[model samples]
Target: MIKDKPIFSVKNVCIDFKVGGKNILSKRSVLRALNDITFDLYKGETLAIVGESGCGKSTICRTAMRFHSPTQGEMTFEGKNIHKLKKDELKNYRQKAQMVFQDPFSSLNPLHSIYYHLERPMKLYHNFSKTERIEKMNEYLELVGLVPAKEQGEKYPHELSGGQRQRAYLARVLSVGADIVFADEPTSMLDVSIRLGILNMMNDLKHKLGKSFIYITHDIATARYVSDRIIVLYAGHMVEWGDVNKVIINPRHPYTKLLIAAAADPEREGKVELPIVRNQESEVTVWTPDSKGCPFRLRCPVAKSECAEEFVNAKQVSENQFIRCIHD
Candidate 1:
């Protein structure tokens, strides 16, 4: 199903942030949010970006949506550079690419009813007649499992439960006719019971509707459940990537194994995984834009002396496993 040229692609994209420019005394510092990150999203495919906190999972989504221009490299949708698009072209790009934010509470306007939130996108993109917009809104709300669609559509976002608000947001994205949806941990705030339902709904949307999805999350389990492919990030560096199950079951990168080990399954009551120890010297060498060698060398348990000498290149260790590390 992932055949043909990619629908969206990020090639060697790097993003840098200028922090602290408020006063003359406060010198601006460069924080690299992404480093030569690259990946492709095919139609009907789900690509998951996974890492611990601050590993730049959310940054990738922002870059693809053109919220932040890349300091280096490029992002393209249907072969056109997003960073260089004109205002009109950019508006069209916005309609085609939609985002489901992490926070359900603030994502919807408190002032507007849920119907208004859903109808706005329909009117903006589809030029739907007043009656048509109402009918479509009801259909979408029902699609997301909000039954008695007409009644549910009229409630304010605050009136809905946290789960319902998320469903409404999903309906809004569908209402706009977006081809790609960037889900930035959309179900992280909900209860465990509710999370499963949301995941099922997203799965239905992906396979049934053939929408491209970029699912960003720190939860490795969910990443495996939702994504066809997985890319693991560490301190802004792409440490590992390939088929989701392959990487999850047999992680090659030291940082990746550490992350998986942390997400132990209590269901496997007697199963055990060894702890990954950190190199003490690495604790003192903080990773920065200018850090030499592998960005993870300092903390990597298997790091060798040569690992600190030059930039590390990613290698294909198995059929689908690509890892960036000094040692095999």
Candidate 2:
């Protein structure tokens, strides 16, 4: 059974990037990719990070994987601070945490065969002998539904279909014996017919293999299908989060409501439109440190003067759900 305790924790993490100034003579400025972002990833559960493009969904996944360091706050794995680990310790940490990139085509080496790709991780992390490696490779290949493992092993990346390549990537992730998998838009590039199959594979990995996953996607429908908990992000800030069902059925934040309403529904064709707040239509704004009050106040229909002047505090609305809104 999955534990209720957190396996990974991101506490008040802020990520900043130094960008070039408008003019050559002007000073450089900082872009806040993430602002005070905090969440816990529990064992054997899929935590879905859903938002529009550039809302820092990928940024959070990268930060969790130790690809990017946070300017402020801390990230811990199994009670150890990931950012403070030594070289050897960091290597060990990586063995437990792995990432599946969006594009399967680019992720795999065109020159190498599938067996070579799968065998390398086993060799690196487990230090298995050549015979042992081949044996394990076949086993993992079959485990991911790539049957007749020996035949599939000899094929290069280009020989495989998009869905097969993705499956191979998942097999590689398992070969490393990863406990946590960070999947960034894993199904965005695939055919619509195959997307569900990939999602089913992920579900099997989580439930049958007992692996934890961080699924980042813009598709709210898919997010709801795959996640136990959901976090809604806006302008690098967590607008709403909690049990997926609770948050989706009863979204409290104006931004969260907007996202849910924006989900694609075939039956509602031509009838659906972008949300307009208080007769005032607004577009998504870029993140800035100088902005005050709520980051979403500009587009909030129920926003008040206080929302534009002070930072909003998170309040527990349900058993495991929290919202950062004053009105709701």
Candidate 3:
């Protein structure tokens, strides 16, 4: 069961990337990828970050994994500052936190067998004898539903189907003894029939192994299926966040409503017309660093004059829900 205390916390985080110089002699311009993002991941629970492409969903995973450092704010893992960890502390931190990439095919080494992939992490993190390692490897493979574990071990990455490859990745995560896993679109590439199985495995890992998870995806339906909490990101800003069911059932942010609407059944009759909130020019530059008001005002149907005058902070709308709109 998940406790009330947070296992991981990201506070007032901001990330900017230097794209290119405007001209030969001009200084390089910066693009803000994330702005003032804050959230927490509790033990044995999954926190899903949901948004459309380029909305900073993956950036949250990257920042949390320390693949990229933020320009502002701090991240803490079990009360320790993540960015300020010493060399040994950093190494130990890496062992505790692992990532499951979006593409299973690209994540694994095509040249190596499944056994080799699982063995390497165990070799780095534990002092298991060859016999013990072999036993544990087979155990984890079986745990992930890869039956006939010994036979699966000898097969190379290319020999497995997409679902099998993803299962191997999950087994590898277990081998490393990761307390937290950042799953970046882990099922996007798999067949629809197999996606739920991968998700169910993740749920099992959370409950059975006491592992915390951050599941990033563009699909709200999947996010709702697997997460305890859901955060809606738009143009690097958090628009709506709360318990997954609360936010999904009573979406307060305009952008979030549009997202839910967009994900609704397309073939159903009496389809609600998605509001066109942005002009052509506004659509071109989705990320605006100089905007004084809400980052989503440009696309919010109910935005007012005050929304254009200053940025709004998140306010508690219910016992477990928060919205970043002044009107809410």
Q: Which of the numbered candidates is closest to the native, going by highest TM-score?
A: 3
Q: Write the per-residue lDDT of candidate 3 for residues 73-159, one digit (tens) a residue.
A: 989998888989999888888989889998999999999999999999999999999999999999999989998999999999999
Question: Candidate 3: deviation at residue 223, Å?
Answer: 0.5
158-198 in candidate 2: lDDT tens per residue? Answer: 99999999999999998898999999999999998999988
Q: Against the true structure, candidate 2 has what lDDT?
A: 0.88
- Point out where model 1 deviates above 4 Å: 21-26, 270-287
Every model: Cα RMSD to truth: 2.0, 2.1, 1.7
Segments in model 2 whose C-alpha atoms lie over 4 Å from true places = 22-27, 267-270, 277-281
lDDT of 1 by residue, 74-114 (tens): 99998899889898988889999999999899999999998
| Poorly placed runs, candidate 3 (over 4 Å) | 22-27, 266-269, 284-289
Question: Where does candidate 3 clash, by residue pair?
Answer: none
Ranking by TM-score: 3, 2, 1
**What TM-score, over all chains together, does every model reach?**
0.94, 0.94, 0.95
Model-by-model lDDT, in order?
0.87, 0.88, 0.89
Mind sharing the TM-score for model 1? 0.94
lDDT for position 4 in model 1: 99
